[model samples]
Target: MFRRFVAIVAFVALAAALTLVAWPQLLGLQRAPVLALAVSFRGAAAAAALAVAVVLTAVGLVLHRLRRGLGVLALLLVAFAAAEAGVLVVRGVGAPDVPVAQADDVTVLSWNTLGDSVPAQVVARAAAENRATVVALPETTEGRARQVADLLARQGSTYTVFSRSQQAGIPARSTSVLVSTALGRYREVTADGDTVGVPSVVLDPAGGQNAPRIVAVHTTAPYDLDPATWRSDLRWVAARCSERNVLIAGDFNATIDHLDGLGPAPGRLRTCRDAALATGNAAVGTWPTSMPALIGTPIDHVLATPNWRFTGFRVLSDDDAAGSDHRPVLARLRPAG
Candidate 1:
């Protein structure tokens, strides 16, 4: 009787743990260590669940006495897997076709060049091809940005560059932004402070009247094993997004899941909404070109204040061999009025 009681307790504990793993937010443990990592890669988590289910089924076939218990555990895993898949489906999976830019439409492209791994010419061509007026590059130096601007100018596309760096030597500490001359001149204004560790660029139009505030973001990656710094960077970015009429782009080092409670509003960090999510492309990942979009994590993004509406968003994967592990994300927006 004591053995049976212990078994029941163990079963209950296992089910509870799995349930929390599948949905960490249930207990506000989404940001906890193992749970945070698990949610970051839902596809992998789901696959793991199914794999364990298969093993459980094999064990059940050989061990009759424990067969029922194992079978129950296997079913639980399968259910968790299905639930994760259902979430992905609900968030979205397919990429939408990019819309042609209108005269007043603003085309923003965000790409982490992996510390200038991609050539300036390639970056220029990408912007021109997409008719991007604003480009945010994380882990890119001012020198590389100038090269891109010069290349664009030689090709009849004029751009003004703004850049910031936490320190010299480390390319990851730098970030660059390019705003087309067509949109008027913009000046770098993040002199006082920046993200917790990674450098981020803040820009304001020359007149600073009736223009959108722009931020080129590069938050510390969680893999640095510095959760505090990572979370602080996210919070700082969120504060910037609170104001109206803002445009933000770059490597956030976080997924929408990780942004919960960090935002001022539900589904928004401050008032900024993720363009990919608004356009139904949130499920498509943007990092680790080695993995399929469905399996990898979406750490890159473009977000805008409520004043702007997202017409289209997509993660560009054709340049898989482009030297950078990240795939470029493009978001097209127009004033909401």
Candidate 2:
């Protein structure tokens, strides 16, 4: 009787896991509160499924004569797990590496500074090391932005800082953008009154005729508190991306999966992860610095329009020790002919 119960429990667990792995959106499970937890840890779920399959297969082989029916069920579970494993592998594969950027390539760095935890000097050093032409900091305050700008100036960088206003009594988070003087003049662009906290700025290159826009984004996290606002914030950013000559970067709070219907069209905004995968580094994640990058969700990104070609992409794992919960994403891009 006890052995029968064990078999039943294993079968139930495997079946539920398989359903989630196979088709989350088919049953409206993607938005379900209970299933949303599974979506966030899809990588870990795949690993767990593989482990269960191996254990169950071993048990089935050992007791084939005593429990022929159990052995068959175990085999079915193994097949389902294998299918999920294939999906995970394909999703995790890195893109092929493009050639390293030329001397004139523009490098942009995006990070969420977690309010005041990250020191201005650390941010400055990282920007200097990468020689970033544009830096986007989400969840940064006005005072912190100034400190970062001052630190960069000390390092011989002439970066002008633009940030959303921080009301005296309000506890709202702000996004900040730092444009290097070498990139020419730039000004802030408003994205309607509702989305004031998300910073958008346009840069007029010193010698180039066209002006490109940069948006530092931080959308609300989709949790029990208010998932609607989270979805709305993402749509707003997507609308901005619909325009030409724009580069959107920072903590989007949504993964590539969550961005499905939010953008102008499918495949409209080019994600840096494509370059990272091509370069054989798709395993690198950029959130919750405490966890290994391979398993953490990559909520931070540097996405660009079709007008720019990505030459290199990297998730700066070394910055995990820099006090912020998110590691920085840096991408090198050149204008597409």
Where does candidate 1 clash, by residue pair? none
- Per-residue accuracy of model 1 over 99-216 as CA lDDT, tens digit each: 8999889999999999899999889989999999999999999999999999999989999988888889887788999999888878888553788778998888886556788899
Q: Give one digit per residue, the lDDT tens place, for model 2 in 149-251.
A: 8988988998888887444423136777888887777766553533434443333344554656777777767675436666666667777666677777788
User: Which run of 10 residues does model 2 get worst, by summed lDDT?
Assistant: 266-275
Residue 232 lDDT, candidate 1, scale 0-100: 78
- Output the TM-score of candidate 1: 0.94
Model 2 spans with C-alpha error above 4 angstroms: 1-17, 21-37, 54-85, 92-103, 165-172, 191-209, 263-283
| Candidate 2 structure lDDT | 0.68
List TM-scores for all candidates, in order: 0.94, 0.79
Query: Which runs in model 1 stand beyond 4 Å of their true positions?
Result: 224-226, 264-266
Q: Write down the lDDT of every candidate, Cα atoms only.
A: 0.86, 0.68
